[model samples]
Target: MEWDWNFVRQIMPALVEGVKITILASVLGSILAAIVGLAIALARRSPHRLVSRSVGWFAEFIRGTPLLVQLYFIFYVLPDIGILLPPLVAGVIGLGLHYGTYTAEVYRAGIDNVPRGQWEAAKACNLSARQTWTHVIIPQAIPPMIPALANYFISMFKETPLLSAITVLELMNQAKIVANTYYRYLEPITLVGAFFLAISLIAVVLLRWLEQRYGRMEP
Candidate 1:
């Protein structure tokens, strides 16, 4: 079968636009995950066993569930309960919440790696609990967490295709639409694969650079 360069060239603009949505969703979702995950991680580390246990159980529940089911529940079920959201809103929330659970675990690992003496030293300096966490522990922990966070962003990018199931017009969804309309999968699908590979390669290079930068700052 001849690969139709003309079709690919013509649809490049559409493909690029769709890729923009893919990037936006992933970036925004990662930001949400970072913020929410930090909170959840801290909650799970609280001195109060009830707070810790509840947060831990919620994180575990989210991690255990299928992302598709979560998406369906948020996008479909919530509307029936009168908490309607736009498709994009639902998609972002679902993706953010799902990955936030994983990011919370990453935060836990990084925070746990901080030396025990660091906490003692902060308290010796008369730092309050909030001050210790904000000024000491998180500052030390966040650098190591950046690489893992970047990797999660890449994972979220790949998962953006799932948003299409909820009717979000992300890259894969747009490609599928084009294919259905034109009765041609070759150009649209190939272009979509190439687009994803290119972006993923860029993300890998960026992550490596960040890891190097953070590694130098850590010690």
Candidate 2:
């Protein structure tokens, strides 16, 4: 097939719509993952051995499993047990959960890097546990962790294509549909690649800026 400028233009709108869905899923998933990761990190640090070990094992299991399998289970398998979710919801959950395990490690590392003296100082001041974490620990830990978290956000964006397996109309899924409908693979697939490359390059530049701004402040 000759390069079809007309077809490319025709498909652009749908592809752009798909791009919006892709970005939405990534942003929402990243937010959920950040929250879940912090919870896991904190739970793993609990004074109770059972709490810590169980959270540790859960994190390990999630990290060890394939994301695709997790997606399938969330979207397909759970319905058998009466938990039905929309495709987008299932995909978001799968992405958040799979990446949350990795982010938990990043959180753990950041939390660990906080100076022991900070903890001692909080104790000396008789600060409550909540006040210490709020005022001292998290503020110190989060900045250095920003660049790493941004990298994972970018990774989650790339992985949005996998949501197609569960029927979410992300970029790759839209591209496949466009190609199938028009019987022209070249333009749609190439455009999908171009879109991903453009976004990824932009994210890389932002990641670099974040690293420069926060990495040097590491304690």
Candidate 3:
């Protein structure tokens, strides 16, 4: 079929709306992932063996499963257990939890990269464990981790399309709706790809800026 300019114009509004939802979901989900992942990372590094092992197993479990399966379990299986969430909530939870596992690894890497001497110095100063973490280790570790955390935000942005499977009506879902209704997949799908590419490109530039800004602070 020939390129359809009229169809593109007609669907532009819906696509724009869908893009907004996609952006919101990605942003909120990333926030959740960052917080949850940090907690998991700290748990994994705890002196207590049980806390560390439990967190390690949970992270491994999440990483091993397909995101689609996790989405299904959250959206479908939960209702059977008397817990029902809206599609949008389920989508956010699924995306955030899945990416949290990935970010935990990133956080662990950053925390590990903090030199042993720093930890020793904190001890030598007679700092409490919490004081050591807050003042010395985290201040050093978190700067390097910013780039990785920002990268996860971009990754989650692309993965928002998976929300369509659970009917979240995000960008890809909107595109698919337009294609189904109008019987023109090329324009809508092409627009979807272009939209995602544009957003991802912008995210990459922002992440690089963050990396450079933070990288300067490290000794």
Candidate 4:
């Protein structure tokens, strides 16, 4: 079928709304993933064997599962247990949690890469664990981790389409609705691909900048 500029104009508004929701979900979900991942990484490093082992198992379980299944449970199954989250909220949590496990691995690797001498020095200085973490380890570890974390967040942004399965109405969902309604698959689907391509290109550039900036470690 021929492309219809008129039809494109008509659907731009709805698609724009979808774009907003998509960005909102990606941003919120990325923030949550970062926080949750850091917590999981720290928990896994706990001195207590039970706490560390249990947390490690939980993170592994989350990483092992499909995000689509996790989304279903968050949006559908949780309501059965009186945990009735709105569609968008559930989608954000689902994205956050599923990706948080992966991000936890990134955090774990970043933290582990810190020099053993740094830990020894902190101990020599009589620094408390909190002070050592806050002042030294995090400062060193986080810089190198920034690029990896950004890459994961970018992947999460691309995965926003999965939110449609849970009825969150992101870009892919909007495109599908438009296609089904007008029975014209070309315009909407193509436009969604263009939008994602443009955004991914921009993200790649930003990722390069992050790699140049924070990817370098200071001695």
Q: Could you give candidate 1's per-residue lDDT for residues 1-219 as a string of tens digits?
A: 679888888778888889999888898898899888999999998999999999889989999999989999998999888999887888889989989999998899899989999999999999999999999999998898889888987998899989998998889989999999989998899888899999999999999999898855651
Estimate, for each residue in 23-93, the C-alpha lDDT of model 2 and write its tens digit.
99999999999999999999998999999999999999999998999999999999999999999999999
TM-score winner between candidates 2 and 4: 2
Off by over 4 Å in 2: none
Give a tens-digit lDDT track for model 3, residues 1-219. 888898899999999999999999998899999988989999987889998998899989999999999999999999999999999999999999999999988888888988899999999999999999899988888887888789988989999999999999999999999999988899999999999999999999999899898856653
Local accuracy of candidate 4 as per-residue lDDT tens digits, 1-219: 999999999999988888899999999999999999999999999999999999889988898889999999999999898999999999999989988998999889999999999999999999999999999898888889999999999999999999999989899999999999989999999999988899889999999999999888762
Question: How high is the CA lDDT of each candidate model?
Answer: 0.89, 0.94, 0.92, 0.92
TM per prediction? 0.95, 0.98, 0.94, 0.97
**Residue 196 lDDT (model 4):** 86
After superposition, the stretches of candidate 1 with alpha carbons farther than 4 Å from their true spots are 216-219
Better of 2 and 4 by lDDT: 2
**Span of 10 residues, lowest total lDDT, candidate 4:** 210-219
Model 2 TM-score?
0.98
Candidate 2: the clashing residue pairs are none
- Regions of candidate 4 where Cα sits further than 4 Å from its true position: none
